[model samples]
Target: MPADLSHIRQVMEEADCLYSEAEVEAAIAQVGERITAEMAESNPVVFCVLNGGLIFAGKLLTHLRFPLEASYLHATRYRNETRGGDLFWKAKPEISFIDRDVLIIDDILDEGHTLSAIMDFCRHAGARSVRTAVLIDKAHDRKASPDLKADFVGMSCIDRFIFGYGMDYKGYWRNAPGIYAVKGL
Candidate 1:
């Protein structure tokens, strides 16, 4: 296989999407609007689920006008592999969020395992309010445990793997400016 986007493109062959840069920017603005209106100005803490949420967080922050703090935690469904492996709670945020409004942001909401876990963590940390935001919300299996329903959802996507706009395939495509669905893996 060739080096540039081969393995990645193969994985995306069935993805069937080609979002433009302008479209992505528009979505971010929409998410920011919801955040600004729904979230309070009481020192809200935006906790990003890293590796994918970094780009989304940055873009969302730029559009958000109110005062807010940011932090990140490393949650991995893949550990140096190209597949979704066991979910691991690795690095935890050191910021203080007790009695504060907390928002967990991620790139996509699939099985909802990681986000659900983080939501549970926020409760344990004494967050007065906890919410979730995601770029894509798929038709997740309802019986796959209770999903951490995102308070804010940008788009309702079919159950398909996607990359771009901060999403990735085998750690690639994270920097893809627009959201794209590859043909196959």
Candidate 2:
């Protein structure tokens, strides 16, 4: 069962931020350092997955000082499920990407289906290389299916559904200060 407000309040009482405010700032700084060191000279194509990845992608861009193109694709598989569901896609961005390096920024990588599909689509759309960047890597029950995984990972997660740092629970807690594990979970 989902945790009640009382339980949530209890957890909040002793709640510890997995990434404190300063930690988040420091991490963002590190992200800039890593991205610049890894892909500065590649002239990559940056793709930010819509809605959830918005916050993380924005912050990441601050550190990515390179010759790159930015685009986005809208794909989601969630309506009301906690765990990942199926797959969905929208119209791809209309930016020329033939033989160009592409980087995808996403909020989370759970089952990897949606992201894997995105990478495949980008390749088909004529991207030379498609790398991925995600704020959180939810590597739970992952099965090798397609030739798509984030070449760049910001954080690692086990399997539990979480919210915060741009992640949302039923579209509610995305703005929460600290990332939160579901209470009693």
Candidate 3:
């Protein structure tokens, strides 16, 4: 089902702003620093997990002063639903991962299922190394994969239904300038 535009707009108006644009940029800069320091020399193939990761990857890529090729893969556990379910692979990168250092960028780390599967996929594709990055790390103890974690994390937040900054509420609000948690969530 599609979200009501009016409700989305109303939620945006009332939702709590978690991080401002400047702060998000600063966090991305810090993440970029770590990526540059560790993976720049490896010429990694950066994979932006599609839809949600687009904005974060686009912004973060600008600060990465390295020679890395950018591509994207489409995978989703939450396809327009508030709660996550099964993983679906919509698309994969055209470039081969063989012997390549793969960097996976995502919008958020909620349960770690998608990221973990992506990491496994990259490894199965023969990637030399696989590292994950996310704009937000949802602070929850009940992760789907407990041992997995992002190599680079921009921000951490209490578990809540969140939107904005490449994350959407019913497929809207992704273009909001800052991170926001849905009101009453």
Candidate 4:
């Protein structure tokens, strides 16, 4: 099936801008500073959760002054849809993170199921420590667990269908300059 380009454009046209580009940038910088403060000397292996994490990781990496090994993994549950299903691993970590501090970066922490699973994988693979950094943390009560939280968070947003800065809506709008919520989502 082909996507309707017109509808895609209209989605953006009608969407509500949740965060401007400058606000997103400021949030990223703040998160970068916090990550650097804690993990700069940890010799961390930073893994960007792909598709959604691409943009956030690229921008956040510049703020870290210390040296770190940067890599990416493609694990997703949404698969370009609004709702999530089972976990799908397009790519797994190819580099050895054994006995090293691991940092997982993603665009958002919605329910934390995928992120939680990734963190568990790191621990089972012998990571000395596993942490997470998310560009946006959705404020809701239905988390994967009561204690599930990102180690570093760039911003907090209400539970809405949001996209931009790596997040997508129906597999589009990931490149939108700022955060936006679908009109009725």
Candidate 5:
């Protein structure tokens, strides 16, 4: 069933604000600075791993003062559901990754499935270097790929159901101004 507006509202109301808008922005600024320092001279192709990564990529890019190109990849594991499943590729980057420094940006790095898969894809496409970045890195030990982690992380989130600031609940609340942890989930 489609998520109703009232349900979304209730979820938002009951959720705990883990990070306010200002806090999130500050974290993004830090991530941007770090990215600039590390990859500014590399001329990286910043690839947003949509659709959750869209907001983060847009916000973070504004703070990055460097020469770079932008693209997007639409690979999903959670298609509007709480549980994850097999990977699905809705779209892929059009730019050639051969000998290019590739930066994959996403909202949350939960299990390392989607992000790790994307990184492998870039390498298979002949990328010289591939790095991952995330807005929130869930503090848990249940990652599907336990050895993988984000290269640049804005903040650490509690292991729980989360929404807001590009994260979502059943395809809603991605635009909730702050990062939130859902209550009773």
Candidate 6:
């Protein structure tokens, strides 16, 4: 199936820009600095949660300034729709993370179901430690776990349907210039 290009264009035209590209960049830099300070010497295995985490991880990795292994895992709940479902693993970590400090970078920490599951998987797989970094933390009470939180968060957003900087809506607009909330969503 092909995307309706006109609808996609209209969505961007009407969406509210929650954060500009510059703002997003600054936040990423800040998070990167914090991560570097804490994990620079840990030699962690960094996992980019695809496809949402793609843009964020790419930008964040440049600031680490440390020796670490970078890889990706494809696990998604929203296979491109607005709603999420059960976890679907398109790919899992192929690199050995046993006895290694692991960092999972993702686009947003919404309900945290996916992130929590990934963290647990790493722990069970013999990772010495597991941490998470998210570009956006949606402020809400309905989480997979009440205590679930990202170790590093680039920004906080109200509960809204958002897309851009790797986030998508109906499998489109991951390339939007900044963070945007769908009109009336």
Give lDDT tens digits, candidate 2, residues 41-124. 988878889877887888888888777787777886665576556656655666877898888888888767778877878899
**Tens-digit lDDT track for model 3 on 30-79?**
99999899987998999999889999999999988889999999987778
For model 5, the stretches where C-alpha displacement exceeds 4 angstroms are 78-86
Steric clash count of candidate 1:
13
Q: After superposition, how far is residue 83 of candidate 3 from its true place, in Å?
A: 7.6
Model 4 clashing residue pairs (backbone): none
- TM-score to native of every candidate shown: 0.84, 0.81, 0.93, 0.95, 0.94, 0.94
Query: lDDT (0-100) at residue 173 of candidate 4?
Result: 92
For candidate 2, the clash count comes to: 0
The superposed Cα distance between candidate 4 and the true structure at residue 52, in angstroms, equals 0.3
Over 1-185, each residue of candidate 5 has an lDDT whose tens digit, in order, gives 66688988989999999999999999999999999999999989999988899999999999889999999989877787887777778997988889999999999998788787788888998999999989999998988676878999999988999988788898899999999999976
By TM-score, how accurate is candidate 1? 0.84
In candidate 4, position 179 carries an lDDT of: 98
Q: After best superposition, candidate 6 residue 182: deviation in angstroms?
A: 0.4
lDDT of 6 by residue, 22-111 (tens): 999999999999999999899999999998999999999998989999999998776777787877789989999999999999999999
lDDT of 4 by residue, 53-111 (tens): 99999999999989999999988777888888887789999889999999999999998
Q: Which of the predicted structures, 1 or 2, would earn the higher TM-score when compared with the native?
A: 1
Q: In candidate 4, which residue ranges exceed 4 Å CA deviation?
A: 77-86
Q: For model 2, how big is the CA root-mean-square deviation?
A: 3.7
Clashing pairs in 3: none
Considering only N, C-alpha and C atoms within 3 Å, which residue pairs clash in candidate 6?
none
